[model samples]
Target: MDLATDLELDHLVGRARRLVVPGRRRILGIVGPPGAGKSTLAGALVARLDGEAVLVPMDGFHLAGAELRRLGRAERKGAPDTFDAAGYAALLGRLRSPEPGTVVYAPDFDRSLEEAVAGSIAIDPSVPLVVTEGNYLLHDEGAWQQVRDLLDEVWYLHIDDDERVARLIERHVRHGKARPHAERWVRESDEVNARLVATTRRRADLVITGALTG
Candidate 1:
C-alpha cells in the first residue's frame, strides 16, 4: 500500500485483527526510521484491538550501554549491530512455534536507564498477537531479513522528512541532549540511518502515514 494516498492505517490494523486465531498467536512487526511515529501507531492499534496484544519492542534487544561503550559503538547506539539482532530473531522464531504450557521471557530496553533489561517481559501463547516495532525490522541484509521472515506481516510507517527530522531533534532534547547536539546528531547519524531504511520501504506488506488520529 502507498501510505501517501492508498489504504489508511486503520485498514491495516483491522487486517491484523483477523490474523488472531483463538488458540494461537500472531506476530506483526512495524518498521520505520526514527521519529516516524511507529511507537504511537503500535500503541494505538493495541489499544483499539479488543483482544490481548503485547508490544515487544526490538529496542529491548539493544546491547547494554556499558557493552556499547566497551565496543566503542556508544556514539552509534541505534545502529543495527548495536542490538542483539540474532537473539531477537531467535525469539521470534520461538514465538512462531510456541510449545504448549511454555511461557517465553523477553528483554526490554529502559530509555531512562539507557540499558537492556533481560527477562523483563513474559509472552504467553494465548496473547494472540505480539506487535514488535523497530527501525531495522524490514532491513534486507544480515539478520534483519530473518526478522522480516519471522513476522507474519510487516508494516512500514512513513512520514515527511522535514517533520521526521524535527521530531527526532525534539526527542533528543527531551532525552537530555542539547539543542545543537541534537540537531547535529539528527543530521549526521539519524539521517544516515534513515536513508538506509528508506531503501527497504518496498519490503513492507503495508505502509502507514499521518498521525494516529488522522
Candidate 2:
C-alpha cells in the first residue's frame, strides 16, 4: 500500500490539527500530478481529523463532458483549459470564509459517469477545516493563480514517473476505457499535464514522497 511512516503520518495529522481554530475556517490544498494519489491522501487526512474536517475536491470543477466536446477540448479533457478554473477559485474563496449559519454545497466528480455532480458535498458552517486536493492548486497561470493565495497551506505529492503513469493507465481502464486507449490517454494527455504540475512543485508548503498508495 506504500503507507507513510508513522512519524510522517503523525506529522501530517498534527499539522492538520493545528490548522483548526475554534471559530475560523481553514482550507488545506493538496496538489499532485495525475495518479499521484492526491485524493487518497486528502481523504486519509480528513478521516483522521474526525468530524472537524470535510473534503471538497477540485475535480468537482471539471468541465462537463458535453461542454468540453462543444469547445473541442474533449481530447484534452484533463488539461488545465478543460476545467472551470475560475469557478474553482471562486468556490474556494467562498468556502474559505462562508457566511454564518450557511451551508455550502460543493461539486464532486463522478469517475464512472465521467461528470461533475453539483451539490454533492455539503460543508456546514461549524466545520473548521476543508481539505481540497487537485492537480492545479499550485499552478501559477490563469485562473489557477488565485488558488494558492486562498489556501492555508498546499502540500505537493511526488511519485516516481513510472509508478504514477501506471496508476493513471489503470485508473482509466477501471473507469471503462479500453486498456490500449488508457495507455494512449496517459501518454498524450495525462503526462503532458503531469509535466506542467511538476513545474509548480516548488510553490508547495511541503513535499510528500512515497505515499501514493496510502
Candidate 3:
C-alpha cells in the first residue's frame, strides 16, 4: 500500500474499531460516484480488519441484464432505477440483525456476466462489521432512503473529475466495451449518474478524498 492508502486505512480502522460491540454488527457504507474507488477502499479496510468484517457490496442489487433489457433500461444500466433499491435496503436491515449461528448470504455482482449471483457471499454471524460499497447508498429518493438509515456510518469517496472520468472509461473498456464505446458510455450514461450522486454528498458522515495508488 502507498502512504496515502496506509493513512486512510489507519483512519478507517480507528473509526470502525470504536463501533465494534461484543455481540452486535456494525454496518459501514462507502458511497461514491463510478470509478471513485469505493470498492478499493472498502476492500482495504476489510482486509485490515482481519476477518472481523465482511464485504456486502450494493452492486449485488443491480437488476439482471436481461431484466434491464426487458424494461428498456439496458442502455442506462447504472442509473438509480436499474437497481433493486428496496431489496438492497432490506438486506442491509438483515445484516444489522444477526441471529446466533445463522449465516446470512448476500448476492454478488459478476461483472464479466453483468449479472447478480445469488448467495455468493456468506456473512457468518460472528462477524462484527459489514463493509458495503456502492454508488447510491446515500441516494435519498424511494427505498434508497432506507439504505442510508440502515448503516451505522457512511463515507463518500471523492475524486478529481478528470481522473474519475478516465478511470470510468478504462473500466468500461476492460469490461469488454471498445475504446470509442467506453468513452461514450462514460460521457453519456456514467456522468449523468455521477452528477446525481454528487448531489447527495452533503449527507455523508465523512467525505473521503484519498486516491488508491497501490
Candidate 4:
C-alpha cells in the first residue's frame, strides 16, 4: 500500500488507529533503506494522527562518532553494528508497557553533530501510538530480531533505485558533505546498508511503493 495519495494515507492512519487501546501503547514501525522516504512517511502519519502519536526514530540509537572511530567503523557508519540495537529494543519494550504518571524520554539523532542526543524526545504515557522509522527495524539478525518482535506492525517503503540514490546524494550534500564525498559515501557506504535492508522487505506486514514526495 503506497502512501502516495490521501486515500492511502487514510488507510494507513486507520490501521494505526485500530491498534490504540485505552491504557496501553502501540508501536508502528516504518522500515526502509536510506533515502526511501521512511522518515517522511512516518512524519506524515504522526501529523495526521495529531497528538495520538509520536515519532521515535531508530537513528537516535546510532553509536557515537568517537565510538565508531575507535571501532574502525567510521566509514561504515550506517551498518547494523554501528547502532545500539539492544538499547533501542529495550526502549521499545518500555514504550509498549505504559506506566501511569510516567513519561519516557528517548534519544534523538543530531545530524549536524553526527551524534545522538540523549533524552531529546519525551513520549508521554498519554500518547497511544509511537511511529519509529529506520533502516533496520525489519532486519532479522542479532539484537535486531528483538526490535522486529517488539513492534506491533512494520511497513517497508520501496522507491526506484535511481531516485533513491539521487536523493541520498542530495541529502548528504545538504548535510554538509561535499558533492564528491556524498556520491562516494552513497555508493560505498549507504548502498551497502541499503542492500542489506532490501533483503528484509519480505518480512514486513505491508510494502509501500511509489514516488514519495514531501
Candidate 5:
C-alpha cells in the first residue's frame, strides 16, 4: 500500500482518511520539521479515534533545560543531542511488546519550565495505537535508528516553506521570545533544525501536505 495516498483526507478534519491495521502494537510516528504542525495532527488523531489510541510525544524525552545549560547547549536546545534518544528508544521497545494490563510510564515536557519531567504519563497496554510525533524519529543514527524499527508506521507532514517560517516565529514569540529575537531564532536556530529534520523525510511511510493531514 502507498502510505502517501493513505494520508489524504477532507481538509476540515486534518486527519488521515483511513487507519490501516497492519498488526497489533501498532505505533504511528509523525515526523516533520519544526512548525509543521505535528503535535496538532497528533491531537486530532487522538480525538478522531474511537478508542484505544493515545499520544506519546517524543518531546517528552527532551533533556532538562539545566542539562542543556550544563552542557553549554542551551542555545541548541532543539538539536538531536539535546534529547535522551536512548531512553526514548528503550521505552518504545518496551511499549511494542504490548503486555496486557501492564502500565508504562513516560516523561513529558513542561513547556512552562522548558524542562522534561519524569513519569509524566502512564500508558495502559490496552491502547491499541500510540500516536507519537517528533523531528528525529526517522533519523538513521544510533538510538534514533531503533525508533524507526519500533514504530509500525511513520508519516511526514509538509507545509509551505514560507508558512513554516511564519509559524515558527509565532511559536517562539508565544513561548516567551521577543519579536525580533523570535525572528532571528527562527531563521538561525529553528531553520537549522528543520534542515536536519528534512533528511529523515524520505524515511517516512507517508508524506502529507498542509494542515489537512499533518
Candidate 6:
C-alpha cells in the first residue's frame, strides 16, 4: 500500500530540507491534479527553505498560445499534449545533474496573458534543492513517462474532490473567465485531466493530505 500522511507545513518543510545532499542538487517534485494546491505548497516550501531551494514549475513548459492554436489544441490546454513534455524531461535531466557555474533559466506561466514567459526563473546551480510542481510529473504515458526517472523524490497532494473542483472554477474566474464558462471548463476540461493524474497517485514516494500552511 502507498504511504499516506497528513503532514503540517513545518513537518513538510523539515522533511524537504532533509532531502538535500552536500555538494549535490536534489529535486523534489510536487504533483497533483489541477487546483490541488501544487503551486501553493511548492511556493511555501521554497519560501521556508530560504536559500536552499528554488521552484521551477512544470507549468512553464506549456506550449505557446499560438502553437496550441496552430495545432488545433486550444480547447484542452491543460492536457498533457499541450506542453512540451520532451523538453520538460530534458530540462529535468539538466536540473538533476546541474553543472558548476551555470545557472539554469526556466520559464513561468503568466496567468494574466495565459502564456509562458521565458527566462523568468533562475535556478542557481548551487541551490541544494529544486521544488518542481505540476499535473503530469508522475504521468507514465508517452514522453511524460521519463519524468519519474529524473526526480529524486515525488510528493502527491490530495484534496477533497468537491473542493478541488470549486477551486478550479474560482481560479478560472479569477483569471478572467466568466463564472459559467469557468464552471463548464472545470467540469469538461480540468476534471478529465484530474482523473488521469489520479491513476498515478500510487507511484509517488509520498502522499500528502490535509490543510497546508503558508
Candidate 5 residue runs with Cα over 4 Å from true position = 1-23
Ranking by lDDT: 6, 4, 2, 3, 1, 5
lDDT of each: 0.84, 0.90, 0.88, 0.90, 0.81, 0.93
Question: Which model is ahead, 2 or 4, in terms of lDDT?
Answer: 4
Candidate with maximal TM-score: 6
Over the full model, what C-alpha lDDT does candidate 2 score relative to the true structure? 0.90
Better-scoring candidate (TM-score), 2 or 5 = 2
Task: Give lDDT for model 6.
Answer: 0.93
TM-scores vs. true structure, each candidate? 0.92, 0.95, 0.94, 0.94, 0.89, 0.98
Query: At residue 212, what lDDT does model 3 achieve?
Result: 59
Q: Point out the worst 10-residue segment of candidate 3 by lDDT.
A: 1-10
Pick out the ten consecutive residues of candidate 4 with the lowest summed lDDT: 1-10
Candidate 6 positional error at 123, Å: 0.8
Which parts of model 1 have CA positions greater than 4 angstroms off? 1-9
Off by over 4 Å in 3: 1-7
- Per-candidate clash tally: 0, 0, 0, 0, 0, 0
Steric clash pairs (candidate 2):
none
Question: Taking the tens digit of each residue's C-alpha lDDT, what string does model 1 give over 120-195?
Answer: 9898877889989999998877787788888988888888899989999999898889999999999888898898
Candidate 5 clash pair list: none
* Better-scoring candidate (TM-score), 4 or 5: 4
**Best by lDDT, which number?**
6
Please, what are the lDDT tens digits per residue for candidate 2 over residues 1-214?
A: 1232322566788888999997899999989899998888888889989999999999999999999999999999989999999999999999988889899999999998999999999999899999999999989889999999999998888888898899999999999999999999999999999999999888888888875332
**TM-score of decoy 1:** 0.92
Root-mean-square deviation of candidate 1: 1.8
Pairs that collide in candidate 4 are none
RMSD, each candidate, Å?
Answer: 1.8, 3.3, 3.4, 2.3, 2.9, 1.0
